[model samples]
Target: MAEPTGAAAPGFELPLLLFAGFRSIIDDLHRELAEQGHPEVRPAYGYALQAVGRDGATASEIGRRLGVSKQAAGKTVDRLERLGYVERADDPQDGRRKLVRLSPRGIDVLVRSAEGFDRLRAAWVRALGAERVAALESDLRTMASADAFRLDATSWFNG
Candidate 1:
C-alpha cells in the first residue's frame, strides 16, 4: 500500500467519502436487522418494500418507481413474496391488477429499520456532536438534489 503523501485528497475522495459513510450506516443497519430476527433482510428488499409502500403497488408500478424493468421488479416481488414480506392481492379498482401489499412481517422490518436509524443517529450525535451532525445534515440538504431521497437510486446505481 502507498503511504499518504500528506497532500489534500483527490477530488474523487469527496464522493468516495460520502459513499463510504452511506455504506457504513447501511452495514450497521443490516447487522442490527439480522440480530433482530431479520437475518434474510437485504438492502434491495428495503428499497423494494419502500417502493411497494403500505398502499401497495403492482410490479409495473414498482418497476417504474425503482427505475428497473418490470421483469426485474417482478423477480423482486417473487423473492419478497417467498420471504413473506409481501402478498399479492387483487386490485379492487382493476380486476386484472395484482397489488403487492406488505405483510405484518414486512411492516415489522420497516419499523425496526426506523428504530435502528434513530439509534444510529443518536450514536452519530454522540460521536460528532449534535450541532455538527445537524450542520452536516443542513449542508447536505442544501447541496443535495431535489430528488436525492428518491427510491430509484439503488437501481440507478446498479445500472
Candidate 2:
C-alpha cells in the first residue's frame, strides 16, 4: 500500500458556517418542540410545512421549492399526514393533482417553531447586542439578494 497525499483540507467557508448555525438553531427548536410534547416534528418537516401554507400547494411545487424530487416531497407529505400534521386533498383546478395543507396540529407546530426562533434570536441579541445582530441580518439579507446566490425556497415563510 502506498501513502497518497493530496491537498490539505479546505477551511471553513461562509456557506458552511451559515449552514452550521442554521442546523444548531433548528436542533434547538426541535428540542424545544420535544419538551413541549411534540416529539414527532423534525427540521426537514418544517420545510415541508412552510411549503404547504394556508393556500396549500402540490407536492411537485414543494419539491421544486425544496430542491428535492417530487417523490421525496410526496414522501414527506405522507409522513406528515401520518403524524397528523398535514392533509392532502384533490386540487380544485386539477383533479388529477393534490394539494397539501397544514392541519391544526401542524399550525401548532409552526407557532411553536416561530416562538423557538424568537427565543433564539433574543438570546443572540442579548449576547451580541441588537445593533450587531441587526447589522448581521442586513448583511445576510444582502448576500441572499445577490444575483449570483439566488435561493428559491419557501422556507422563510410561515406556511
Candidate 3:
C-alpha cells in the first residue's frame, strides 16, 4: 500500500503542534496589542507582568514565579520600569526590600492585552465553534493541572 500524498507522517509530535499553535496565538496577540497602541511588550514581558500582579510582589517572589534568579527578575523589573510599565516602592513592612507594582500605563497595557486575547479567542470561536473551543479550553486546563506539566517561565522565556 502507498502512503497518502498530503497526509502527515505518523512521526508527527503533538508537543510540536501545540508549540506552533501557541506561537501563532502569541504572534497574533502581539500584533493586536501593537494595533491598539500597546507595543514593545513581548510574551516574556507579559509573563513577568503577570507575575507582578495587581497588589504588588517582591522581586524574589516574581523570580520564584518566573523560575528565574532574583537578579534576572530584577533585570525584568528594570526593563519594565524603564518602559514606564512598573514602579518599585519601598516595602512598608520591610525597609530593605521594594515592592513592584504595575503603573497606570501597565494597567492599560494589561487591559489591551486582555482585549487582544478576547479578539483572538473570538476568531477561534468563529472558526471552531464555541462548543469546540470550550472543550479545548477545558482539556488544556486539565492537562495544565497535571503535576508533570510544571509552569516554568524560564523554560518558556529561554532565560
Best by TM-score: 1
**lDDT by residue (tens digit), candidate 1, 1-159:** 243499877778789888988899999999999999999999989999999998999999999999999999999999999999999999999999999999999999999999999999999999999999999999999999888998898888888
Error of 2 at 153 (Å): 7.2
Q: Could you tell which candidate, 1 or 2, scores higher by lDDT?
A: 1
Model 3 per-residue lDDT tens digits across residues 1-159: 245579875565667667787888999999888777777888888888888998899999998888888898999899999999999999999999999999998999888888878989999999999999999989988887455443354556574
- Candidate 2 has what TM-score? 0.78
Q: How many residue pairs clash in each candidate?
A: 0, 0, 0
Q: 1 or 2, which is superior by TM-score?
A: 1
Cα RMSD for predicted model 2:
7.3
Sequence-dependent TM-score of model 1: 0.94
Candidate 3 vs. true structure, TM-score = 0.85
Per-residue lDDT value at 95 in model 2: 97
Per-model lDDT: 0.94, 0.82, 0.85
Ranking by lDDT: 1, 3, 2
Model 2: ten consecutive residues of lowest lDDT = 149-158
Candidate 3: list runs displaced more than 4 Å. Answer: 1-11, 147-151, 156-159
Which residue pairs in candidate 3 collide?
A: none
Q: Between the candidate structures 1 and 3, which one is better when assessed by lDDT?
A: 1
Best first by TM-score, ranked: 1, 3, 2
Evaluated at residue 139, the lDDT of candidate 3 is 90
Model 2 Cα lDDT, one tens digit per residue, 1-159: 222359543464556777877878888889999999799887778878888887999999888777777997899899999999999999999899989988999999999999999999998899999999999999888877555332234333324
